[model samples]
Target: MNSSYANKSIAVLGAGESGEAAARLLHQEKAMVTILDTAEENKLRKKIDALGAEGIRVIADLAAEHESLHGHYDYVILSPGIDPAVPLVQHFIKRRIEMIGELELAFEMCKCPIIGITGTNGKTTTTQLVEKMLNACGVKTVASGNIGPAFSAKVNESSHLDVMTLEVSSFQLESIRRFHCQTSVWLGFAADHLDRYRSMDEYYVAKIRIFENQTEDDWAIVNYRDKLPALKAKKITFSAYVPDGDFSLREGVIHFRGERVLAMSETNLRGSHNAENLMATLGVGFVRGLSFAQMLPPLREYKPLPHRCEILRTVNGAEWVNDSKGTNPDSVEKALHSETRPVVLIAGGKDKGFEYDLLTDLVAARCRSVVVMGEMADRIEAIWKSRLPVANAGRSLEKAVELAHAAAQPGDVVLFSPGTSSFDMFKNYADRGNQFRALVQALPS
Candidate 1:
């Protein structure tokens, strides 16, 4: 247990997974901890009761008791969901209380080296790949942060782990103070979280913070295609479209600085995006003293995670793909380009302030028809209607799947890749994708 936290008062500003984990960790460290959430009491009754059983204070309606919290805490642990611009955060900020994220708090207690992966997309896939590869090569590792479990939840097991493969997000990086990864892999960057960020630049600034504290001993694995800022760590680059980086795709083979690492045919992972993910995974493995031969077994046996261009079934010759993880325009664009057959695309979800017109030309050329759904359906339809046959499914994902099925020819592919978030009509992207899969599976052959 950390002696410094024993007498300090810490307020965790969220009751979600990460927030609860952070509060629990602080309590274990003998800190005076209070967890606060703006959610109604009834909604979080079980969680609140559970935490209270352990003698931890949980404020269910934080907004209602906001004023009472003044001058109480020495530190505030911000959950990824809590916006810094909110009044509660600003209040703590103005008072000069030290604020940190669950990621930072966990980092302070972790004894193992961390391999951090961050980007607009593919962070989850790359994090999983690196974890699996490390474990296969006899390294004790756990996938944490934005992917498996909250960093705080897994920090106690650091002594048992040789490495922690973390999926770092821009939100988690925002409140980090001294958190630094041994190796940081930036998959790629694209415009995302516009609703939370003031601009694309703001989002980029948050992501680049992953490497902010790294020194010459650390490594920064980046995409050769992205125009990123300079970093102090030693850099390694990867590219799927070209053979110019340290790891690159030349013809159909993956190469590491002119040596052939692996061939695409040997792996189950498809799409150029997956190739990029593979290269980044290789870069991480290579830096950790792992050889391509040592990591090949896991790489070949690895199955793609559900909801990222996963094929559900081929019904009556038309392929149904569930890319529910494609929650941004850039991800959807990659999915569209990866398909060979004419696509009957089902897209649109909660608006993140992304411009749909940017995909106008690509949709016109690749899709046989477009089925739009959720909050941004009409807005997306307005952008693509002139370019292709666009059908509005309103807020129903079931209707969207049916429309896309009807529009699909025997040889065509029906792709459900919502180019924005899934908060409008679903719990999350996984919920949205699962519903799409169920709807597709129930269809008559």
Candidate 2:
């Protein structure tokens, strides 16, 4: 939270980008900071070197040998990806070592107002949309948090801004203490991170934590259908269903208090899911004094983010889409339903323990074929095999793309909508998506 950091001995776990940023900022604040990671030193050399250059001690690949050093730190700041359930991390927790994520640390330092967005999906798109709306209205804004630069960089920022639009995740929200946004948006929540959380209830709790430190003066933008418990902040709802909600979409027009704001055709963003995203952004914009005219241009002109059901190009009457950002069952399900053409779904990756049952009916209607690969290929194949024809697209990403392309007819769409993480075969989802883009681009016209 917003506390003095003079001479505070802090241990920043996981020497990744966020860890380095937190360590660097804390060091500037006169906190004695040390870096720690279980990954090999060489793999984390860039961050480790940056911290090392600052005269910070970095203990790489912390094993039993580093156990003795844990007791020296006053607090531990965890990076987003490193779960607190790590046996060593648990050791510190059970003993009452103060643990706060980098978001909480950054909140302590940022002087500007913040708009935080979190959900099961559409978070990045919605965050970008809100930032675009604010910036177009002549308000200084930056998209940070999980999307761009680490939040710690804002601590030393001398520039003035109206607000910072943040894409927060449940992982970052897990350890927040005093992190509160002037306007907080919970786009929607579902069962995700089952791999990290002990139960669905635990994961949902972390997401709702975004509103924890907010006061009654703060605004909470949420889904019209969300059954959230009573909160400290005032609620503003956006609905794709009920037209009576604060921000509603009906008959091709976006309604703010039952008055037409913008038409669905004007905003290039597609799918019912994105309609919900637009409604959330419009809700935040309404509270911030932005009119429909100001938000019109960006919503109309801004293209979809790469790998979020982006159409690469049409080749020989076939369209290949990259929805690599669809790394969950719900997102992939939405992607499949949004496609107008027959779908040859390039799906599966590292398992997140998601239930594919939700996608069953949609794929049965839209997807003609499912090409699967990666760690959870067999499991995913089994899920769709009963509904439609499922083929093992082999282990390589390129092979999977090739297989999907081969299976596609002239009028069909090859959708790379992997419903899980890409770590089993590639560095990350971006890498997987980039390779798919490259391979798709190379296909003969």
Candidate 3:
């Protein structure tokens, strides 16, 4: 047990995966820990019972206990799902109680250097790729943060890791104070999380916090396309369109510092977005003194993760592609551009306060028709009906898939790439994607 945290009172907000992991970690450190969540006690009974067995107090229905929590902690461990603007957070702020995210708390305890990856999209894919590449090159590393298990859960085993590839989200970065990454990769950025943030700038501010504590010895891998502010760390740029960066795609091959590195043909990664992800992964390997030869095995063997432009099945000549991970307009735009065949796109979900008008031109050019669904179906149809054929499937993802399949022709792609969150319908993107795969597989030949 760490003496610094011994007997320290800590409140962990939101008893989700990250919160439970944080509570466990704090308890192991001998802290007086309490887990608070807004969910009903019945819903989280199993989790509560497990934590209670470990001597950690869990208070469900946080709103009812909010008043009782005043002045009860030395610090608060905020889960990523909880908004900072919530009254409980505001109360903690008013009292000057130091609040940090699970990511930050994990960083404080992590013994290994972290390679933090953040972007509006491709975060999970890139994080997985970097972790695979590093481990293949004989570097002991693990991928965590927003991807797999929470960073706090992995901190206990950090001593065994040479480094960690963390998928950092803007939400996790919001409350970070001293969190720093040895190699920070800002893959790319676009408007997202508008519902949680006041404006795009506010969201960008949170995302760029990955570089807040970097020193000269550290590295920042960024896209040349994104205009970033001055940073303390040495910056390495990568791009799929431009050839001027330290790493870039020129012709069909990827070049590093004007030298040939790897050909795009050698890897299974598709799309310009993935090209950027590959380059960023290479940049991390470069910083770690890994040779292109050493990284090629993992890079060559890597395949796209499910739900991100994953081709599910073919009915006649039409391909059913699941891009359910495409949760924002930018991601949908990329999915559209990646397809060579005309797409019958199934889009729309819970609106995140973004305008679908931005995708109008792209949709008109790349899609044969559009099928909208979930809460934003009407709004998406309203935005695209004038420019192209649009059908509203309301709240049924199955209906959206049927509509898309009906609209698809031979040699065309039936793309299910919802441009908003999955909360309005299914449990999450994976659930949405899994159901999509099942639905598409069930379609009559």
Off by over 4 Å in 1: 1-3, 64-68
Clashing pairs in 1: none
Q: What is the lDDT of residue 2 in candidate 1?
A: 33
The residue-by-residue lDDT of candidate 1 on 1-445, one tens digit each, is 2337987889999899999999999999889898877789999999889999997889877663466477478888999988989877787788888888889889999999999999999999899889889999999999999995899999999999998889999999997888989999999999899999999999999999999999999999999999888889999999998778998887778999999988888988888899999999999988888888999899988998999999999988999999999999999999998898999999999999999888999999999999999999999998899988999999888888878888888999999999999999999999998998999999999
What is the descending TM-score order? 1, 3, 2
Arranged by lDDT, best first = 1, 3, 2
Tell me how many residue pairs clash in candidate 3: 0
Can you give the TM-score per candidate against the true fold? 0.97, 0.95, 0.97
User: Which candidate number would show the highest TM-score if scored against the true structure?
Assistant: 1
Candidate 3 local distance difference test against the native: 0.89
Q: What is the lDDT of residue 400 in candidate 2?
A: 87
Model 3, runs deviating above 4 Å: 1-3, 64-67
Q: What does candidate 2's lDDT look like per residue over 1-445, in tens digits?
A: 3376679888888777788888888888888888877877777777667667877878787785576455577888889989887876786787687888999888877878899999999999998888887888898888888986888766556147778889999999998877888999998877678899988999998888999899999999999888898988988898876776888888767788878887878867777788889999988988888887788887887777888888899887889889998888888877876778899998888888888877788898998888999888888888779989888966788888778877889999898999888888888888889999999999988
Look at candidate 3 and give me any clashing residue pairs.
none
The positional error of residue 401 in candidate 2, measured at the CA in angstroms, is 1.9
